[model samples]
Target chain A: MLLSHPTIGRLVLSAAVTCGLAVPSYAEDILIGVATAQTGGLAPYDQPSLAGFRMAIDELNAKGGLGGKYTAKLAIKDTRTDTAATITAVQELVDAGASIILTPCDADATIAAGQITVAKRIPTLTFCGTAPVLATAVGDNLFGTYPGDNLQATVIADHAYAKGFRKAYLLVSPDSSYTAQLPEYFAEVFKKKGGTILGTGSFTMGQPDFSAIVTAIKALPEQPDLIMTAAYEPDFPAFIQQLRAAGVTTTVYGADAIGTGTVQGLGKLVDGTVYSAAGYPTPGGALEAFNKRFETTTGHAAESAYEANGYEIGLILDAAVKAAGSTDPVKLRDAIAGLDKLPIVTGTITYAGTNGMPVRAVSLIEYKDGKPVFIATQTPAAADVPAPAH
Target chain B: MLLQQVINAISLGGIYALLALGLAIVFSITGLINFAHGELMTLSGYALLAALMMGMPLLPAAVTAVAAGALAAVAMERVAFRPMRGASVTSLLLTSFAVSNLLKVVFQNAISARGKPIAMPDWMAGVVPIGSFTIGVGPLMSIAVSALALLGLELFLRRTVMGAAMRAAAQDFNTLRLVGISANRVIAVAFLLSGVLAGIASLLWIAQRASVDPMMGFVPVLKAFIATVIGGLGSLSGAVAGGMLLGVMEVALQALLPPSLAPYRDALVLSGIIVVLLVRPNGLIPAVDTARS
Candidate 1:
């Protein structure tokens, strides 16, 4: 086709000459791709991840790039936190010669990117893609750096059990599958652990009034020991505040969504609330280092799970690229699957074979007088919890 | 459970009523729906939030929010609705929609882009227990505010000369023109009144969810439109009644339905509307006979 078209032929001849002229000075660089939420409701997740990824890449380059032969060149695209945008971002990265792709933000978006990566046989690592369905959905190519939601639920239940909360009041939103599943998962385990569910109340999303639900909880003959809620950050604070206002002083516990900036966004309202988290932000270790480097580069502190996941996934991608030695997708996939003990700021990340799901320790953190304090770390007995019944 | 559902419905209905009242006032006099009504509410909520963030007192913050909403309404009249006076209804509707979109984009950029929960004041954060049921202060505030706004509006229409003139203009602009009252002034008053209603509604809305987003106005606007249609197009009393009825029906249906069928709540509401329209044809209350033919 190039030879048949005169314009193409002339352009190809000129390109070949130009390449030949510059070939001696050209140096090879490993291209790493990032597909993350840059806009939408998930921008809080994606923006920080992008910052963390860049900081990690800059640090690696300062230490003399991956494999000592190639400097890492980061290619980032805004997924807009939508499924279609995520797929497009991955395809664009693959088209632009990315060796490996990084997934950040929502589980659905990450899973969508995983499908593309699997088709292209590229090694893809995600920071916050924790929906259990993604494991069976994307199979081999998808790997999560953060522990899945199952671990989060287990950690919360165990923490409650350890705290001697025998009866728990559960508040779940039926609108969100994420919020709905957490309570369902916790109920099963909490029951197994011998905790009685005192009361269960349902609320639809966007209903600001929780008086009926709160009133219901408050009327329980013997007040529950704890309030286990599965709700988004926006709803979580309001729910917590209302619960406090209703004179139900039962200690409140929440799922991973509460650990996000949405909780921090609550400021003083977030005090005394305990929530499950993947990692902690504190004094000078890996996380602190990551935070310092991230803040230096991005002008903001890494305050949420998405940022931690993104920073850690970048480290994972760097390791896989170093192990693979080349940008070949097949080699990178094999290298990632074979990763035995990759160290991340969050934890010691290890992939569970072709499932590509990370099995890491989950942390329980509480907001004490307006600051997040790490409470305990719990490891799920089983890394892969079966999907809950519909 | 049924009583709780009833309360839920009332709170929701009250919000819908306020939204409808805001939209209906504009429609009644100006004959334009002001598609930006939802944004006006959202902008007010954000203004209150911005004030709170700026360390202003809550009362001042709330006042600023209403003032901001009113100012925005005035701006809308000056920049969008006023210019297109006497144009086709379709053109006016399109202009309102365009203004809504522009405001949404601008607000998203200026504030947190997507929806972020606006924090409630410490005073508005809890529930008041009444007998067996509990209700959030936010919902109570919503119901109280809507009732007061509607009552004040009804009195305004009855007692004030401007309000009387507005009713006259809405009933027959041509006749009012012959009487030497400027049609523009009456229309502008309508917009201002609607803006105040929207501003008040914004406070109630943010109080309920404790959050505000750019597109948050879409659902409220849709509910308001449905309420205004179900109630009569030009009747304020009908709009209030329709909003409360819709809210109560929605919450009651939600309480009655099984978990598996909960997602179909909006569908069930629409189905009920279809049945009602089929029976009434001209809404639950007909427009005042004196207003038109």
Candidate 2:
């Protein structure tokens, strides 16, 4: 009786065909390579993205992949978050005969892999590489699925300025390129907007002690309206907790790295802090279906905004492949670069007329009583974004 | 403002002292700068996380975590360090480094390379105000715990026979071995004491940081090494003094340095330390070749 049902029978037939038990006479298989940091400091960023990537691919394959002609098969290699290892992973994926490659989230780690994909002329998309250099310096073949970090900085600066925060104190983390660049971008926008930077401090990553920084804040001659920090996890929560505990309740503004499990772990201490990130999921927005599938696949709901960005890679690639009408590397690369206003899971993504920075809206999420609530979505104005020297 | 900054310095310094003392204890007895000691702190953090996840109360979880550190140190000494007895300092240092990396890798693969969040107790999150200044419960706890631990360690070293044997071993290892004292017991006891210090340090650190990661131990261990060098290697009192000095100097530099020069604070502080070491090569309190009183 179950097999007799029309929908169930079609599903069974699709499953059998997908498993290759029932051979299709004219079916084609396309191999996509994924070179990512499956295990390393970058793993946290890439893991969720990998999940999203798989979910998108699964959905496509289920509905008959690529005009019902090409079924995508993945060749995955772990980068281990090391440059040498990343190159090796990319080489392995390329050798596996993949037409396209997906790189890791961290820009520095993604560069070497990106170079390989560029040399091979494969269309390489990064799930969350925020550095603007990925667009300008890496290569033309390398495209980023996430918004550039400069856009995030502009959005935060504009948000703070709009909220009447005239004086700002900044904190810099000198561990990674992303953290180091955040303050520079923020200071640039804030200064340009007639806001005064009251003071600045710095800390090395993994240095748990923030008391010195706290003491410095308390000793400031004049209190700033907002405290801006560009710090990553483990250190991010520690900094926020110590600042609040020391009774310096100035509104804290930070980069996308602020929306992490570590910040959530701070309970009520993280309240009132604001940050900008890539994607914001609504109750019935584009992400609802993917989020539900992601929950079933990962057994947990998506935490980071990059999940949507990760899911976008598949949609972007599908669109590119369709536009190219061929799986040839050069043609696909050109097609992806020429993508204009193509709707993806996050929003409409277009590589046309812009540097590798994808024109997308960033969610300004603010913490209220220890939970992040969607405040507003703002698109970074092109005039507001400063071009990177590189 | 001055009063609050001073409190901040002392609280921060106390933590450094606890870490430095652990390094000092093992160094004085065995002359082995145990780089793996930081992994013991990491282990303690994991233990605390595990206990909390199991729904244990804060005090009990903290105790369990500290005990885990102590046990891990003893186990490490018994398994790894004991085999390399009478080895060159270079070999021992290499072995310690190996142990540190090995532990880090294991933790990374087993748990996560990313940090795991550990919730703080509400009591530890409170801020107490006195006059014009306010102190966080986390910092207050760190200061109180370090002081009590140091006092306890001092009493134990001064009052116990085992402690006396450790001091004698530090002064002259061969002489202590020849004088009918079991060198093995003395070394093992030194490691046990070191583990206890690291365990206590982990509790206060986790309370403040509120998260755990495999790499968490690396920076603190570096600070401990720096503090030990500055305090006078092998001198317990010197170690404590050095830790407090480093903590205070760091805070003071951050507070006083102008905004433009602020980012150079660490560089300036290290330069200052280098100048001091140039003057006092043996450190601020050079270790005297004598047993503890």
- Candidate 1 — which pairs collide? A208-B208, B9-B248, B117-B211, B118-B210, B118-B211
lDDT of 1 by residue, B1-293 (tens): 45555665677788889889888878877778778999899889888878888999888998999888888888889888888998877898899899988887677556655456566667676667789756566556667777888889899999999999988877777898899988878887888888888898888777766667766677788889999888877777878977887887776665566556755766788899888778877677766642431
DockQ of candidate model 2:
0.44
- Fraction of native Cα contacts kept in each candidate? 0.18, 0.66
lDDT per residue for candidate 1 within A245-286, as digits (tens), equals: 545667878877667655655655667678877777657666
Looking at model 2 chain A, which ten-residue stretch has the lowest summed lDDT? A18-27
Q: Please give the CA lDDT of all the candidate structures.
A: 0.73, 0.81
* A1-390 per-residue lDDT for model 2 (tens digits): 345474465466435433434222232767787778877677778878887888788778887775355777665666777889778777766765678888888777777787787776888888788887786777788887787778889999999999999999988866666887877788899999999998788886776778878878877899999988878777787887788777777888888877777676666877778988876777787766667778987688887777777888888888888888777778888888899999987678889877666888888988887788888888977899877645
- Residues B76-169, candidate 2: write the lDDT tens digits: 9999999999898889889999999899889987887768878776677678988877777778878888999999999888899988888888
DockQ of 1: 0.28
i-RMSD per candidate, Å:
3.9, 2.1
Candidate 2 lands at a TM-score of: 0.87
Error of 1 at A66 (Å): 5.3
| TM-score, one value per model | 0.85, 0.87
